[model samples]
Target: MGQAGGGASQAQEPTGLNKLQHIRRRCTCLLPLAGWLMTCAVHAQSAPTQSDFGGAGLLQTPTARMADEGEVAFTASRTSPYTRYNFTLQPLPWLESAFRYLNIANVPYGIVPNSNSQSYKDKSIDVKVRLWPETHYLPAFSVGIRDLGGTGLFSSEYVVGNKRFGSMDASLGLAWGYMGNRGDIANPLDVLSDKFKIRPGGFSGTGGNFNTSHYFRGRPAFFGGISYQTAWQPLILKLEYEGNNYKHEPFKNNQPQRTPINVGAVYRLNRGVDLSLALERGRVAMFGFTLHTNLAESPGPTKLLDPPPPVRTQTPPTQTPQQVDWSAVSTELRSNAGIEVSKITRRGREVLVTGEQQRYFYPAKALGRTARVLDNQLGADIDWYTVVATREGMPIVATSVHRQRFDDLLDYNIDLSTFRRSVEQDTPLPQREEVLYRATPKKFDGGFSLGFSESLGGPDAFVLYQVSADYDANYHFTPNLWWSGGFSANLLNNYDKFKYDAPSNLPRVRTYVREYLTSSRITMPTFQLTTSRQLGTDLYGLAYAGMLESMYGGVGGEVLYRPMGERWAIGADVNWVKQRGFDQDFSFRQYHVATGQVTGYFNLGYKDVTLALSAGRYLAGDWGTTIDVSREFRNGVRMGAYATFTNVSAAQFGEGSFDKGIYISIPFDLMLPSSHVRSANIMWQPLLRDGGARLNKRYTLYDLTSDRDSDLFQDNLQQITE
Candidate 1:
């Protein structure tokens, strides 16, 4: 026995050690995972944390916390390389204030000096207050002020809005700001005496003490607008008018004041993001991002007081001690039966009327009781004639006659009861059957396109052909969010044959420039993760981050506000994009610009025809520092005219002078039904030159090519060309 016990003890020793080793390995593997899960749990819990009422209530409507209800919320966002901080406070149920700050350090600087200047800073501060809550016939109202502080200039605006119908909201507002206008004079001698003029107040007759002095003033401006919102999608349409007038003292020139009418539309691509286009004096396009925080909880429905209970009473028997009919008791009973029957009939009618009145007054509580009484009364009237019969010697007979003249009364009640039952059961016949119509989903939206663009009087002109195919799919992972992706490929061919005559008056020769004839094919595969939410009836906001090929990555946000019933809307957006290049052969570099735009749109209807106008400005970018206007027909089909005017200098080939132009474009959409194909649009743009000394003198062929020749010959050539 001792020997066996010794062997067993030895066997159990290794088993114990093996078990310990297994447990240790498991702990080693699971420790880090558990820690990671705990970290994630903490972040998830902390990220969307909310305060109740007065910093202690659950966050509800993002705008609510901004209004008074003693609710306050804080939300933060990061789009790597940029971080934003948002804070909201609610002092009243109808009032709110939101503050936002955005900072980016990797903003791109382009080839031009000011095109991508390091000092290109952008910032805005806005405050909004609700004026009135919604009413049955009146719209909700609100007012706001926006202060835009940026690199070049600063401006402020006051805005007002009204909610219309049950789901639409509209707004109108005015703004005024000062823009610095500096002149470029090659020779100061032209404006100075002996190149050193010192006027009484200053060298330039301005009230400054120095020669190189600065003059500044704020120009008065005003604008009015209206807008609408819809629920089908986050769609906002807006229309407005903006104008300003100013004068330059030293130049003694009056700037052409603009009274630009504008229209625009914005569709939320997702929560925190949107796509927008507008036309004013020129065309403005924008992609933006937005962040929202609920400041208070939305109020629940109002409560109503309960109705008073009904009073109850008993009626004493009306019949009193009267003459006894003992001799003919049976006959008397029969005669009296008729009076009883009549009394029952009158009581039943009174009961029905009382029940109906109760139902009308307290529908919820009385409906069931009324139904039960009606059923009981109906049953009593139907069976009132029931009686027992005795068989006579030869045949069945009414032995005692039952002495109940109430039989006729019962029969009459039964007949009336049947009629009433039929009447009650009969309802209005349905005129039509209900139908459910479902929209069919499209799978592919792909096509090839061709386009031609030219400058009427510039050295560059091109006829381009492009073949492209696109596919877009939206997958819903939840009720309020979707994941969308699209792919497209485009091939471009440029024709650049030019005919020019030599200065010696030789015959014109046709030559093709290699740089102009270069063709490129670009394939863009795009993907996006988006989330969207409805603000109220017609207001919504979206935020999105997307990638287009390996070169372009973008993040932005947008907001749309549409009043319930109108066809106008207002939208605003802010966005940032970073585009990288792969190589010289495939790279086209542009300045990294952060832009904000506020647009308004109007839809004028005439039978089947609709006309639209849009206007807005690119608030931060140097490329589109102008007002854009366009008139669209048939929802972007057919021909439309557009114009763009800018104060920024043009591209180098145009001698870097300020540029402006108007053009007419014809757009056609081709739709096919065989595949998942939606539609494709082809646009043809014919240039229209603006007639002005500045534009005409800026890029004259002689001026561009003049440095290669003598001044006298250049002037002669310029005269001949003109």
Candidate 2:
């Protein structure tokens, strides 16, 4: 089996440290597999880490076993001509996905070299799904596709099974394509179709196609491996039989195969790291390492602050609403929840506090905490505390809570049904004399940010990276009206190597990517005026004008209708813009266009899953629908996949057979809750073609007004008192 990029893995929840004693006290059937943490003498200790190759396997091939859900790993391993850096993520117990960078040291970057004979790097994708779970009598089984989408230099398909007995795990499988180049066995599915009798030579010279027609259509071979735990924990011995003879390596260079048997050893250095060494072909020596973590769980930021105003044991003294020291309450709100109070008013027995959310990710925590503040400052006579959660100074939801019941609810003393009955959620109308305190909106605010833009796997360069620093600010004229802008300067990049452009017959909508990156060190990607307002109880409206992004300048508007506490929402957006000149300096290109979309979103109600679909005209006049599916973990990590299919034919779409990519978003709050305000996102697309490109707009109302969804409150219910 071919494997690369291996290091270490450590996965523990924030409170996992306290469970070590318990884990050491008992041993179970799965104990042997996790006994790496302790010496063989103390076999009860479970190692909180997992090792992998090809995303979810031991070496070159996949196994029925899957990584723990939400586990993420990065691997870098090498043998000789082939070195790979791969990213693996497990979002579900039955699914595994990975994106890889395969470097062939023997292959030149291009026919015409820039200097020395450099290696060729290819990007590829792999996915595996379990078909059956391992039981007392049966092995776990799974089906997978490797190097299926991208340059198909190492493409193949396989079905594998895995089983664990005592201190040993064994796997066996059948493969095709690059995995079965030896042709050890005749075509197995030839009876189904004559096409299955022969395999194609190679994929289209121009890559980036989700070509499924070639799957399982070739000679098959057998591959198997067995790993055993040694007397010492953390040291496992492995032996395997390879299916491919390496007769057809990349770049047309065939490799020698001395034998089919491979022997290896894996050593655990620490909880988060592992070291491996192996003998391949009885000639090549290989070594590597891995680094991994559990995205599903992590320790909460450990910083000290005012303890959430101790959940009072007894009710405090009463006070007139006018005498409730407003300034002191404002300071408490900012210190505990990062909420900026805009206005506070009292109407008889109920008090209304309106504010903008700036810090706490859960508005429920903010809402619940404010109620506690009122409970301590006012008497029991004051029956209600209402919060008008605002976004950009506009009211989104007016949530009312019964002060007495809120305390019981937050303390986990009451059921959701009983607690929900004590609260009322509504959309507020105009008011006259109720406001007792009003905060003058800040006219200007700004901050600093850092980001990177990168592209990989082109004939010109293996990897192109651009790191930039940005300055962004927003000017508030009214609560609902504002102007925002940002300018970024490139601090480092390898754009100088971006000399060659792939052949394309379509419009140059995205072909000038290099020109824009090299044009200037500083660029104004955005400068715009925006306004938001509630059109009705469940409908919202937004309008914006000016430079929307580095690629386009436009004026746009959007309208959305999302019910108060529902799983579905629909919206529409329209824009008109001209391409920005390479200089990114106020000059526009001759190319211009108008585009828009009618979008719909649905909550799948399974493990934070959501589906979104959009149909519209694209930037290059192509009409299409883009479908996106994503799942957000409770810890704020989001993994998603998207595909856009348009009227444009495959040939016209250029290098990419169609538009598709996978993305992951990491929320900073998971690392530094007190300091985080936004999440960071990374996208990996096979190719940026013109067929399904869209203007990169800066803002959207749906994201801005998200608290309107009922699930938002349920997701964070346990954090109410924190």
Candidate 3:
């Protein structure tokens, strides 16, 4: 990271002249080529390594495991040398994305009067879709796109790789991009009249013009590399070669640009933790640390069985040894032949009773039936036995029998009140009342922001103003989902004016009429019920639907991936908005718009010298797009540049007329000592050229965290959820 020091000086100027002069004095050479060579050299030397300041996690393990049996991994770094930190989240098995913030500290203010006042602004976001996974010798592949904020469209790589051999793995990649026809010029004349054209000897309409489109078309770039991961060690080494070709009129000088070779290494400590370092000339030596936590672990594993052990038992015993009945004892000695039977033994003697009739003896049979009944009720097999002895001390006889049955014996008479009480006591109780207090006033969470821009080029200078805002909130009536509501508004106003000088030194015809001053705005209020489920660690999939403006509503879904670390996030939303048109000329249209954004932020250094950047791009209806980059310096100093482009071909706006412009601003924090005070920032915004009428720059001071009564503060307070 670069240190913050000194005001605007000769050393800070970005020019080929200074670079050439420095090189010529040191080594005999012209400056432009030398500067280009120096840039490449710097890039080569400062290439990312596992141990560089922000190169951590260069060779980390896969973020998520495969449900089937395959592995996928992805890693990325910012393209600019000034970038300080980059991070990504890949919670889903198939998707990957990242966000990066570059540190361009101390961009000089007052460069073009009101134009260069903004301070500290840098940001970028990237998203990649894996198209194929490696199988055997085949390599994995992916298609990705990056939004460098104001820098324009950056396509991503299609990677192919081979299995690691010893300490080495080889890979190849290809990328392509179409740079948006957008840029800022130091001098307005370069983009104005033919006299100031870039090609001095060329005919009319040969060079720069504000209205003339400079589409870059699509340009392909290629890169290849060989990386080595040492066996049984934590070290990984890599070398890469990359080049690109731009096929566009605006970037004619950058055709066949060859990037310097990069060399770096990564060190891994565990599955989701690693350290990295990298170096590139003119860029800072970067070092970074990364730790990934799986969200799948949050909910824990699932259980397949409920109400565990069922009750059952063996049959009960049915019989026991018995003695003969006294009344029947006299009949047991009789034989079937009608003769009286008599027996005598040493252990027993025959029994005789008066007035007894002769009868044969038979064992009692009721014991067996009782035993069978007991076995059937108890679901168990049981044995029954019976024994009889004579009254005169004769020997006894015994018999045993077994019984079995299949039946439920145990009664399920559980106490419901007792079970309910146990559950109520064990489960955690939710907070009945939550104290809500204001934690210092904050900026607006959602509101309309109006901005105006002027075109300094051409015989005509034009001014444009834009207003955009969105209101969103959620109410949780249940623990699982929420009632979501949102409102959006957008407006744009454009005015054109121009003045030219004639050849005779007299004032040329001045056209002051507003050539095509138009404005359009839309207001939409929506209500939806949303429910989301965890798809991975820090990742979720949500579906929602409800009435919109009391007219129409349609179902939609979205996927959001937030890495364990808060530095980066990516999401995709698809909605089918339906509305019936009004009977009059101004009627509503039913349509659907898909939108997605990847966002991220990171600190460049420690303490008062730190720099931070945040970047993002939004894709919406009719290919409408917005890019923002912001950088902040220590002591609350910040600078930012933003560009918004819209191709409203599908809307009422025709193809020939579209809206596009850029806004740059610098803001500084002014702290004061007071009990109810926090901090405040002052912003400087200048209109480059306002419809042939240039106005003085404007400076505004506002509370950093707005006061309770402030519009920003009220908006944020209402957005708060309990």
Candidate closest to the true structure, highest lDDT:
2
Error of 1 at 643 (Å): 2.6
The CA-based lDDT of model 3 is what?
Answer: 0.29
Q: Rank the candidates by lDDT, best first.
A: 2, 3, 1
**For residues 480-582, what per-residue lDDT tens digits would candidate 3 score against the true structure?**
3566554444443333222221111111111111221122244333465766554554445666666433233456665655443233445555556443232
Question: What is the lDDT for 498 in model 3?
Answer: 28
Worst 10 residues of 1 by lDDT: 1-10
lDDT of 2 by residue, 109-183 (tens): 663457234467666788889998899999999999987776677888889999988888899999998877777
Query: How many collisions per candidate?
Result: 71, 13, 41
RMSD of 1: 34.7
What is every candidate's alpha-carbon RMSD to the true fold?
Answer: 34.7, 8.1, 31.0
Estimate every model's Cα lDDT from 0 to 1: 0.27, 0.70, 0.29
TM-score of each: 0.27, 0.88, 0.30
Which candidate, 1 or 3, would have the higher TM-score against the true structure? 3
Rank all candidate structures by their TM-score, best first, as comma-separated numbers: 2, 3, 1
Candidate 2 vs. true structure, TM-score: 0.88
